[model samples]
Target: MDPNSSKRHLINQLSPEDLKARLANESFKRTTVSFYKYVILDKPEEMRDQLFLIWNKLHCYGRIYVAKEGINAQMSVPDHFWNEFKEQLYAIPEFNNVPFKIAVEDDGQSFLKLQIKVRQQIVADGLKPEEYDVTNVGQHLNAQQWNNAMDDGAIVVDMRNHYESEIGRFANALLPDAETFKEELPEVVEKLKGKEDEKILLYCTGGVRCEKTSAYLKHHGFSDVNQLLGGIIDYNRQVETEALENKFIGKNFVFDNRLGERISDDVISHCHQCGSACDTHTNCANKRCNVLFIQCDSCRAKYNACCGDDCQTYVLAPADEKESLEQRLVFKRGKRFYKTDKSA
Candidate 1:
């Protein structure tokens, strides 16, 4: 059998449970890294296929999106193959010298399968490209500059969604209550309507969202706009290494199995189920009702890691009965599953 075919067969044969168990027992190290760049791509679909072949061969796994605008990738690569992976990535002219933001915490289970797709936009903000010059984004501020700007009382805004900022954010940062980036841009503009002349700051999980948002704001005539150079992931790394003041508190929400990483020893968010102060995010155990929500340890045990009592009861039903119930619910409600912003 071909080596690639054998590897594919092995991956296909393993169930999610089997994959999790295998990850737990594996001894090799894996590095989780994220990076994004906005540059014109002539053929994103072809690029997507090429990347998939390379990454899959190296057993790399994560979510990667390629678009005409650029590429946004959050992937886990085996430590032994890390150098080779970087070499191949940098060989692509557009991705040359792209900076990577490594995760602060790595458990080697951040992703279980390699997925690459071509999309309309790498980081969707629902903005027309002709309306705003995305290349002319906000000023890039390092950790020190961001801290100084905060100390100077600049109008800092968390450019991420409500659920993202609910768990962690910079002190005194204006967090818009919008759910998606598309909703956030307009709402943020409305919220800071009168402060167009004020020095504005923005940040997001990996800086991709901020890159677009800051451009949007600047196009709207917001003066003196700045953004954290690499977002919170890089900010936390710099804070620890440079001994800078950690202004961000609580857990930084991440899109992976880990859900989040502790930036500071503060539980700033509360459990949605019991209202206990907790920052841990978990998806409902009942897959059909996989709502992402914060849950306390006590509540986790009581509800079997479910979102509510209703989901808990659903989990208790036998497999055959559960399937029947799901079908009935789908017919009655027009959908078997519902998701929220909290959904991972």
Candidate 2:
């Protein structure tokens, strides 16, 4: 073996601050794009290493998950390298012809660094292998068809977790009070117990969760299960292009650094701190208590961008007493301080 080959590291070693600085200093433009494909991979670890090298060479920055079942990725690529990135990625047999969903609202600073992780499953549905057949998914519907179904009284269900749907969803969609997909699956089943044969329309951020959810519904004897073809992302895109009636209201929650993108001007959700109308999701400034929550500009200033008074005190406390203060304060809302259990 060559001695120089030992120096090749497959992971990023830069700190977040350094990565952000590097991105800030760059002169070129970047485009935010996301794509996922559920194709079987014999050796995910090897594939991960290969992809890291490929993407790193292209100066791409984003998060990607690889598993035996498939791969899911969301990243920003330099505009100059976009064509090359597409060509090289499409050259891979497993991901050949995979559809790309470009961010409708992009600021180019979506990600600061590259992170490719190997997981047991890409989306973390928490199910045994025999629970449902992914290959046997529900019918895929475009924006027009989905709207028509809604017009005909088809049941609309948000397949995302509580925090995601808290900010936006279809006008009459059934929003589950689930914190995780594993919990949501059973909850949805119970909610639709009596209407197994009725039309079910499920949607998520980028259509990945709905892929599994639609199949799970079918496994539980749901006959007319359907999903948004590309989820809220594509639905919004089509709603703009085709000039269709937009049924979705508020911001569409995302997993990137931006957190979310606006789908409409309506601020349906309220600030978790003050109950003021706001849809902006932000994490507490207190590093130790980085709970995700919605905050308006006013509460943000009052709380110093922390979740609540306790978190704000903890953040402002001197470094010596910070630990003791954290120990003494029994946070009013527990670990996830701002999480809501209420559902529509």
Candidate 3:
């Protein structure tokens, strides 16, 4: 009997506990990776289904979003099938020669299940086709070039949301105050209103956001605009490989079970609960209030990994009551509570 045969016959839907147990018992390791490309697609739904089928067969699991604009993917593939997965990906005309940015640190459980969906846009910058020409993006700087730009005192901008940038970023980078990519676009443009002609550099987690942002800045008449090619993940990898100066301090916040990867030994951010110097991000344990926040070890033990007293109480409630409360609160305020500008 083949071990992978059982997985092949398994259905997509599985209870969270069952999925976690299965992943734990698996013998082989998985490689986590992410990649994105901006290219035209005629039928994203068809493409999504095809990719889901192919990736599932390869024992891959993660979130994937495809659109007419392009595809954005983050997945964990079984180590043995990695080459086959890449070959199949390259076989597709659209994804041919696409560069994948492997995760800096992976625990083989970044995601529990496979999910591929079709969306309107890949990175959701809230710009209409008439608003900005994405093809007119700024210059792409490799690791060394990016470091040089930083040394030359280029105005660096972090194109990620406030929560994402709160944990880590390039030293002196302009951290935007917005919550989503949509809001960040306009806010960043306004911030650089007077310095359009100055040398402006932009970066994000995986370079996808900066790709759209640089185009937006250029469309708004920024003369000298550049983006860190492949963003912080690639930058960290290059810095380690080439022994270059790592100007990026603290952990790089990522969207996975491993919330971040340490680029340097600097803990630049403080815990939200205790105000202790920490860069670790964690979601509230209370299902009703799964707000993302920073917490130190002491705070985590005190709050039981919940955000506050109310959340701790909710999480400690009976299972049946907890589910009921979660339904009511999530329906009323959505799944997560976002801090307002004043509160933030």
Candidate 4:
């Protein structure tokens, strides 16, 4: 077999349990970081393979997506190899000096293995090539400038999904009831129908989403579009360093194991169950119906870490009845699961 193919086989053979065990035995600390760029690539698959080999050697682990458009990655690097990792990454012409958004809170075990795959686009915006000029993005505003804009009553919009923004956002931002970025673009355009000429600001978890969203807004004739420089990650760092007023409240939702990081001392959202103040997000403990939802500590204990009473009951049910129970149930509002068709 070819050398690269042999290595790929070795990598593919490691199961999730194997990766977890390996991570548990590690003694060194790791740093979680993320970065993205919209530069064009000639061969994304080749680039993916090359990066996997290089980063795997350095013991770097994170979820990464590469495409003809560019790369979007969130990974953890061993502390000792941080400098070497940066050097190797920046050596590539397309990614040279690409700004990194370091995670606000990191325990180093955010990812257990390195997984890279080639996709059509780095961030899925559901747009055609000729639909908009992505390079024509909004003005980048640092923490201080963003605060100033907010003080001046600038129209701020959360470019992320409803789940993300539900946990945290800038004060008074126009949040669209969207589940994905694909849905958000058109919704935002429709929401600000009369204010197309207004100074609109867009922001997301990292700066990646806004890079494409700002351009999409511009294509729809929104003038004076701006985005928070480096999104909330860098904004938090700057706010702490410069002693600027933190206009954003609540947690900054992230995609890694650590679901979110605190940017302020406020919990703007409530527990989806008990309605108590909470911003912590977790997937339903029921592996079969792993819906993402929020629960308070009390509720978490009451539901046995599942979504609600129904899921908790199912979890406690006999193994043989699990499949039959699940097949006969449907999701309900108060109780996550309930009997619908008894045929099963």
Top-lDDT structure, candidate number = 2
Counting clashing residue pairs in each candidate, in order, gives 0, 0, 0, 0
Local accuracy of candidate 2 as per-residue lDDT tens digits, 1-344 = 98757536777889888998999999999999888888999999999998999999999999999999999999999999999999999999999989888897998899998899999998998988888899999999999999999999999999998888889889989999988898999999999999998999999988899999988888899999999988899999999999999999998999998999999888899988778899998888877767788899998999898887777888888999987997786454424444352210
Error of 3 at 134 (Å): 2.0
Tens-digit lDDT string for candidate 3 (1-344): 88776445433778999889989999999998999999999999789878978998888999888999999988899999999999999999999999988888888989888888788999877788987787899999999999998899999999998878788888899998877899899999989999989999999999899899888888899999999988999998898899998899888888878889888888888888768798888888865456788889998999898777667767778877876665544321223333321222
Return whichever of 1 and 2 wins on TM-score: 2
Candidate 1 per-residue lDDT, tens place, 1-344, comes to 66687335323356888777877777899999999999999999889878888887888989899999999999999999999999999999999999999998888889887788789999878889775787788999999999999999999899987778889998888999876789899999999998999999999999999999888888999888899998899999999999999999988898888899888999898887667798898887887767677788998899898776666767888877886666644221112212332321
**C-alpha lDDT (0 to 100) for residue 72 of candidate 1:** 97
In model 4, state the lDDT of residue 224: 92
lDDT of 1 at 18: 78
Candidate 1, overall lDDT?
0.85
Candidate order, TM-score descending: 2, 4, 3, 1
User: In candidate 1, which residue ranges exceed 4 Å CA deviation?
Assistant: 1-14, 327-344
**At residue 41, what lDDT does model 2 achieve?**
95
TM-score of 1: 0.91
Which of 1 and 2 is ahead in lDDT? 2
Off by over 4 Å in 2: 1-8, 331-334, 338-344
The better candidate by TM-score, 2 or 4, is 2
- Compared with the true structure, all predictions reach lDDT values of 0.85, 0.88, 0.85, 0.85
